[model samples]
Target chain A: MTIFTNFFYSFMASLFFALLFNAPKRSLPVTAAIAGIGYVVFILITQNLGSKPLGFFLATLIMGLLCEIAARVLKMTTTTFVTIAVIPLVPGLGIYRTMQFIVQNNYEAAVQIGIPTLLAAGTIALAIAISTFAVKLFLHFWQQ
Target chain B: MLNEQEINKIIKIVKLEAQIILENGGETYRVEDTVMRICRSFGLIDVEPVVIPTGMFITISHDNLATHTIIKRVRRRTVNLSKIDAANLISRQLTTGRISLDEAIIQLEQIIGDKSKPKILTATASALSAGFFTLLFNGSLFDFFIAALCGAVIQLFSFLLQGEDMSNFIISLTGGIFTAVIAITATQIFNMGNMDLIISGAIMPLLPGLAMTNAIRDTIQGDLVSGVARGTEAIIVAIAIAVGVGVVLKTLILMGGGLN
Candidate 1:
C-alpha cells in the first residue's frame, strides 16, 4: 500500500514536470514509469541501508541509465525524461528546512541539517557524472 | 552547393541550432560537441564554439580564407527538451547526409516556430505535479488537494508574468511566499495536512534541476566556465527558494503561529 501510493504520486510529479519541460507528448508515460522506478529504488535502498545520500546516488544512477536506454529505444533526447524522473529524489525539502533553521538563529542545528542537504546535492551531481561516463564508455565499446 | 555562400549559410545554421540547444538548457559540452560535429560533417575544420549560461560564440574557419562567426546573446533559458530533441534530430540527419542544408534550416525553423502548450494545460501540469509530490512525501489527501491548488496558482501566476522581465530569483521568491501563505492558511483553518510537505511540493517544480545537472556534467568534463556559471545559477536559485520560505515561516512564527 505504501509503495503503491509512493509510486502513484511520483508518477504524477514526473508527468507534471514532463509537461512543463515541453517534452514530446508521446514520452510522458515513459517519463512517469521511470519516475516510479526511481522512487522505488530510492525507497528500497534507503530502507535497507539507512543512508539517504547513498540511496539518492543509486536511484539517480539507475534512473540515468534507464533514461538513456529509453531515449535510445524511443529515438528521443535523454534530457526530457531524465530531468522529470529524477525530480522525486532531489533534496528540495532538506534545503528548505536548513534555511528555516538558519532563520531561527539555530546555527548548530542549521549546520547539522545543511551538511546533509549539500551532500544530497553533491550525490546527485556525482550520480549524473558517473552515469554519463558509463554511457559514453558503453557506447565507445559497443561501436568498436 | 559547397560554395562560399553555402558554407557561410551552414555556419549560421549550426550556430543557430547550437544556440537554441543552449538556450533551452542543454549541457554546454553537448552544445560545443554538437556544433563541432555538424561542422566536421560539412568538412569544415577549425570550428570553434564557446557556450555559457547566457550566450554563445562560434567561429568557423575554412580553407577559403573566409571565416564565419556568430555571437548570440540568449536572454532566457527554459527547460524545453523538445527543442533540444529536434535540434539533435536535425544534426544527426545532416551529419548522415540524409538531409540537405536548406532542409535542415527549414526543419529548425519549424521546431522554433512550434507553439508551447496552452497556458491552461501548463497551469494544470503545475497543479498536478505539486499535489502529487506532496502525496509522495506522505502528505494526507486533503493536503494533496490544497497543494494542487497552490501549485496551480503558482504556475498560472508565473506564466502570466512571464514577459514582465522578472528574474528567476524573484519568481521563485514570490512562488515560495504564496505557497507558504496558502499551505499555512489551509493547515490552520481546516485543521488538516502537513505544511512542510505541501510547501515543498509546490516549490519542487520551481527548483533548478536542469541547471544543477548541467553544472555537474560540465564540471566533470572540465568546462569550468560553463560549470561555474550553471553552478552559481543553481545555488542562487536554491538560496532564493530557501530564503523565500524561511522569511515567510519566520514571520508567521513571530505572528504567534505555533507548531502545535
Candidate 2:
C-alpha cells in the first residue's frame, strides 16, 4: 500500500517487539520510529531499484548507524534498540515459504526461494556489521 | 587503578557483567570487549575473556601474573536487550568518573538478571507485534486477529516454560505445531483465503532472527567459535520449527482435514 501505511505497520511491529524484550520503556518510541524509517527505506529501494538484496543491505546499514547514534544519545547499548529496529526487515516470510516448499517435497522450489532469501539475510547481516564497526571506530577516534 | 581488595571486587563485578551480557544475547566480541574494558578501567593490566554461546571464561592478571579467572556457565540464554543496555551503560560509567567502583558493582548486580515484565504486558506485546507483522505481510484484519491471539498464546506458553528445563528445540517445535494447528482451524472457521499469510505471520514470533544475526556478527568480528556455535543453534531452531509445522500439516492432510 502506501509508504505511510507500510511504515506504520513496521513501527507497530517494532514497538511491540521492543516491549516483549523488555527494552527500556522510554526508548520504545524511538526504536519504533527508527524501525519505520528503516522499513520505509527498504521498501523504497526495493520497489524502485528492483533489487531485494540491495534494499536490505542499504536499509540495514542506515538502521545500524541510526541505532548507534540512538544508543549514544540514550546512553544504552546499540543492541537494545537495534534488535527491534532490525526485526521488521527480517525475511520471515522467506524462511517460512522455504520450509513450506521443503515439506511439500518440492526441493527445487525450496532451493529457488531459499537461496535468495538466505542471501538477503546475509547481506543484511554484513551491512549491519559494517555499519556497527564504522560507528564504533567513529566513536573511538572522536572520543580521543 | 585499584588495590588488592578493590581488584577482587573489580573481578567479581566484571565477571558478573560479562556473564550477564553473554546470557542477554550480546555479540560474542562485544561481551569480550566489555569485560576487557571493565578490567582495564579497573587497573588490571592483562585481561582475556573467552565467550561461547553457552559459557564464558575470564582471566584477570596484573604484572603478567594471573590474579583470578572466573568461569560462568550461562543457562537459558535468551535475547533481553535491555539487560545488555544497562550493563553496557554501567560499564561505561564505571570506566568514566561518573560511578565509583562500589556503585558500579551495585548497579551491575541490579542489571545482572533478566528483566521480566508482567505476563499480561508481554502477552499483549506479542499479540500486537504479531498482528502488525501480519498486516505488514498484507494479511487481512481477520488473519491479523487470528495471528495475534495465537501469537500471544504461544508467547505465554513459552513464558510458562521459562522456568523448566525445556530445550529451545522442544519449545519451538511446540510453537510450530501450535501455530499450524491454530492457523488451520482459524482459516477453516473464518473462511480466510490466505493460509500463507496467516502461517507466516504467526511464525514470525518464532523465527531465530536475533540468533542468526548474532551468529553473523560474531563471525564477522573473528569470534569464530561463538559464531559457529550460534549459527548451529540458529539452524537447529529453524529446523525444529519447520519439522513441527510440517509434521502437523502432513498428518492433517492424511487425516483429510481439508486445510485450505
lDDT to native, each model: 0.84, 0.83
List, residue by residue over A25-89, the lDDT tens digit for candidate 2.
86899999999999999999999999988899999999999988998888787778777788888
Calculate DockQ per candidate and list them. Answer: 0.77, 0.72
Output the worst ten-in-a-row residue range by lDDT, candidate 2 chain B.
B108-117
Q: What is the lDDT of residue A76 in candidate 2?
A: 80
Write the residue-wise lDDT of candidate 1 on A27-110 in tens digits: 899989999989998998999999888899999999999988898899887777787788888887887778777877889989
Model 1, range B36-142, lDDT digits (tens) per residue?
99989888878888887778888888775677788888877767887898899889999999998989988888877776658888888888888888888888889
TM-score, per-candidate, Cα-based:
0.96, 0.94
TM-score of chain B of 2: 0.94
Worst 10 residues of 1 chain B by lDDT: B160-169
Model 2: clashing residue pairs?
Answer: none
- Top-scoring candidate (lDDT): 1
Highest DockQ model number? 1
